[model samples]
Target chain A: MDLQLIDQFAKNIIFEAGRRIRTAFTYDLVVETKSNANDLVTNIDRETELFLIEKIKSFDSTHKIIGEEGMGEKVDSLEGVVWIIDPIDGTMNFVKQHRHFMISIGIFVDGIGKLGYIFDVMREDLFYAIEGVGAWYNDSPLRKLQPVKIEEAVIGINASWVAPNRHIHHEKVIELVRKVRGTRSYGSAAMEIAFVVSGKLDAYVSMRLSPWDIGGGTIIAKEVGAIATNLRGEGFDFFHQDTFIIANPSIHQELLEKYIVQYD
Target chain B: MDLQLIDQFAKNIIFEAGRRIRTAFTYDLVVETKSNANDLVTNIDRETELFLIEKIKSFDSTHKIIGEEGMGEKVDSLEGVVWIIDPIDGTMNFVKQHRHFMISIGIFVDGIGKLGYIFDVMREDLFYAIEGVGAWYNDSPLRKLQPVKIEEAVIGINASWVAPNRHIHHEKVIELVRKVRGTRSYGSAAMEIAFVVSGKLDAYVSMRLSPWDIGGGTIIAKEVGAIATNLRGEGFDFFHQDTFIIANPSIHQELLEKYIVQYD
Candidate 1:
C-alpha cells in the first residue's frame, strides 16, 4: 500500500469534515441524550459521521468502515483494510463548548494501524502519523518525546477517576494527582492523546474509552515515542472498550505500577 | 475616574503585552522555581510585568499597582486608582505548555472594580469588562449567564481540592465532583474565570489563589451575572490569598453550603 497516498487522502477527508463541523457551529445545534444524561449527541455528530463514511466509501468501496455514530459497517473482525472513525470524539464538548473536540480516523490493515489523523476541528490543527514514516503536527515534524519525572509531569485525567467511583480506587488516583505538576481534563480523549504527542501533556489516563476514541491518536502518540496501554500495563485491544493509559515512556510503567488500582 | 478611557488604555497595553508574549514563545524560556518546585516563574513573566507597569505608570504615575512579579507598590489600602496585574496568570503553563497562560489586569477605583481584562496570550482572545457597562469577548458583548443545575454544570476545579489537603475536606469535594456533569482544570485561574463568564464552564473553585490570579476575571464574571466569593460564601478580599469559588449564581450558594468545609 502507498502510505503517503493514504495519508493525503485521509487528511483531505478530515479537513472537509472539519469545515462542515465549523459551519454547523454557527447555527443553534439540536442535542439529545445518548446512554446517559451526560452522554450527549448532536445533529452535527451524525451529519459529520455520514459525511466521513460517504467520502471513505467513495474513495474505496472495498474498505471496511467502523464509526461511532453507527453510520458505517458493523464488522466483528479487524480483517482487510479497515477505517475506524470518530466523527466528533468529544461530542459533549462539541455540544457544550463548540471547541476542544476533534475528528479522528485510523486506517488499519489486518489490525495493524497504518495511517492516522486527528484534526482539532475548531483550532484547525491537523495531527497525522504514517507508520514507519513519522508523525507531523500540521506541517512540522514532531520530535521524540523526552522523559519527565512524575513530579514534573503534567497529566491529563478526568476528575471522575479521583471521585468515589466503581472503576478504580479513588485514593490512588488522587495520590497521583497530587504528585504530578498539574492535571488537566479537556473532555476529549482524542485531544488528550494529541496533547501527549505534542508534549503539552505528559500523560493521559482514563478508566473506559471506546476504540474509536483513541484509535487515531494512539498512532500519532506512538510515533513520538510515547506508550499506550491498558491500566494493567498490558497491550491495548483496538477492538474492545477498555481502560487506557497513554503516557511518556519514562513514566507510563511507574504510573501503572504505583498509582493505578482497578476495582475489580 | 473615567472608566471608559482607562478601559481603552488597559486594552491597548494588554494587546501590546500579548504580542510581546507571542514573540517570546519562539525563544527558549528561562524558568525559575518560586516557593516550590511546581510553582514556576519565567523571565517573560517578569518582563511582561515590567512592560505593563511602565505603560500604567506612563498613563497615570499616581495609580497604585500590585503585581504578581513584585514590580508594583505595596499599598495598604485600595484607595484611589489601583491596577492589579498578573503578567502571566498561569506561569507554570507558560513555562511548560506555552499556550494556556493568560495576561490578567483588573482596574479598581477606591476598592471598587472599575474595569477588567483577561487576554488569552496564545489564542489572542481578550475578555474585558467595564463597570456598569458590559463585558465583551473581543468585540462581541457577552450575554447574561444562564443558570445551570449542579447535575448539568461543568465546573473548573483542580484535583488538589479533592485530595488529602489542608484547606478543605476532601470527601465533600469528591462528592461534589461526582455530582457535577463534568469538571475541567485548565491550570490558569484567570482562564477558568473567563470560562465561567463565557458560559463554557458553569463554575470555578480554587482552594488558594492570590488576588492577582482572580482579580481581573472576577470583574468580567460578575459583569455577566456570575458570582465570585470565597469558599465560605463571603465576599473576597482582593489584598490576600484565599480559597475561592466563582460560579453561576444558581450553583454558587449550593456548592459553598454543601461542599466546602474549611479545615479550621
Candidate 2:
C-alpha cells in the first residue's frame, strides 16, 4: 500500500469534512443524548462520518471501517486493513462551544496503526503521522518530545478524575495534580493528545475512551516519542473502551505507578 | 476623559505588546518561581509590563498603574484613573506551551472599570469593553450573554481547586463539577475570563486571584451582562486578592447557593 498516497487522500477528505463542519455552524444543529446526558450526538456528527466513510469507500473499497457514529462497517476484532474514524471527537465541545472539536481518523493494517490524521476543525490545523515515519503539524515536522519530570510537567487531566468519582481514586489523582507544575483540560481528548505531540501538554489522562477517540492520536503520539496506553500501561486493544493516558516517554511510567493506583 | 480615545490608545499599545510577545518566542525565556512552585513569572512578563507602563506614562503619567510584575505604581487605593496590568497572564503557559497566554489590561476611574483589554498574544485576538458602550472582539461586537442553567453550563476552572488544596473545599468543588455539563481548565485566569466573554465558557471560577488577573476580564464580563464577584457573592475590591467567580445571570445564584456552600 502506498502510504503517502493514502495520506494525501485522507488529508483531502478530512479538510473537505472540516469545510463542511465550518459551514454547518450557520445552521442549527440537531442534537440527541447518547449513553448519558453529557454524551451527545449531533446531526453533523453522523453526517460527517457518513461523508468520510463514503469518500474512503470510493478511494478503496477493500478497507474495513469502524466509525463512532455506527454508520460504518463493524468487526469484533482489528483484523484486515481498517479505518477507525471519529466524525467529531468532543461532540460536547462542538455542541456547547462550537470550537475545539476535531475529526479523528486512523488507518490500521492488521491491528497496527499505520496512518493517523487529527484535524482541528475550527483552527484549520491538521496533525498526522505515518507508521515508521515522523509526524507533521500541518506542513512542518513535529518536534520530538523531551522527557519532563512529573514535578515540572504540565499535564492535561479532566477535573472529574480528581474529584470524587467512580472511575478512579480521587486521592491519587489529586496527588498527581499537586505534583504536576500545571494542569489543563481542553475537553477534547484528540486535542489533548495532539497537544502532547505539539508540546503544549506534557501528558493527558482520561478514565475511559473508545477506539475512535484514541486511534488517530496514539499514532501521532508514537511518532513524537511519546507513549499512549491504558492506565494499566497496556497498549490499546482498538476494539473496546478502556482507560486512557498518553504522556511523554519520561513521565508515563512514573504517572501510572504513582497516580493511577485504582480505577474502574 | 474621552473613553473612545482611551480605547484606541489601549488597543494600539496592546497590539504592539502582542507583536513583541510573538517575537519573544524566538528567544529563550528566563523564568522564575513566584509565591510558590507553580506560581511563575517570566522575563517577558516583566518586560511587557514595563513596556506598557512606559507607553501609559508617556500617554498620561498621572494614571496609576497596578501591575503584576511590580514594575508599575504601588498604590493601595483604587482612586483616580488607574490601569491594572498582567503583562503576561498565564506565564507558565507562555514559558511551557509558548501559546495560550495573554496580555491583560483594565483601565478604571475611581474603581469603576471604564475600559478593558485582553490580547491573546499568539492568536492575535483582542477583546475589550468600554463601560456602558459595550464590548468588541477585535472589531466585531460581542453578543450579549444569555443565561445558562448550571447543569447545562460549561465552566472553566483549575483542577487544583477541585483537588485537596488549601484554597477551597475540594468536595464542594467536586460536587459542582459533577453537576455541570463540562469543566475546562486553560491554566490562565485571564484567558478563562475572555472565554466567558466569548461564550465558549458560560462561567469561570478561581479560588484566589489578584487584582491584575481579574481586572480586564471583569470589565468585559460586565459589559456582556455577566457578573464578576467573589465566591461570597461580594463585589471585588480592586486593591486586594480574593476568590473569583464570573457567571452569566441565569446560573450564578444556583452555583453559589447549591454547590459553593463553603469555601475559603
The per-residue C-alpha lDDT of model 1 at residue B248 equals 90
Which lDDT value does model 2 have at A153? 92
> Fraction of true inter-chain Cα contacts (below 8 Å) kept per model?
0.62, 0.88
- lDDT of each residue in A28-84, candidate 2, tens digit only: 999999889899999999999999999999999988899998998766777777999
Give each prediction's DockQ, rounded to 2 decimals: 0.73, 0.79
TM-score of chain B of each: 0.97, 0.96
**Candidate 1 local lDDT, residue A231:** 84
Candidate 1 DockQ category?
A: medium
Model 1 Cα RMSD, Å?
Answer: 1.2
- lDDT tens digits, residue span A17-90, model 1: 99988988789899999899988999999999998889888988989998888888787878898999999988
Residue-level lDDT tens digits of model 2 in B1-264: 888888889999999999998998789888888888888888888898899999999998899999998987688888889999999888888887777898999998998899998888988989899999899998899988977878888989888888777666667788889889999999889999998987888888887799999889989998898888998899987777888888877888887777655443
- The single-chain TM-score for chain B of candidate 2 is 0.96
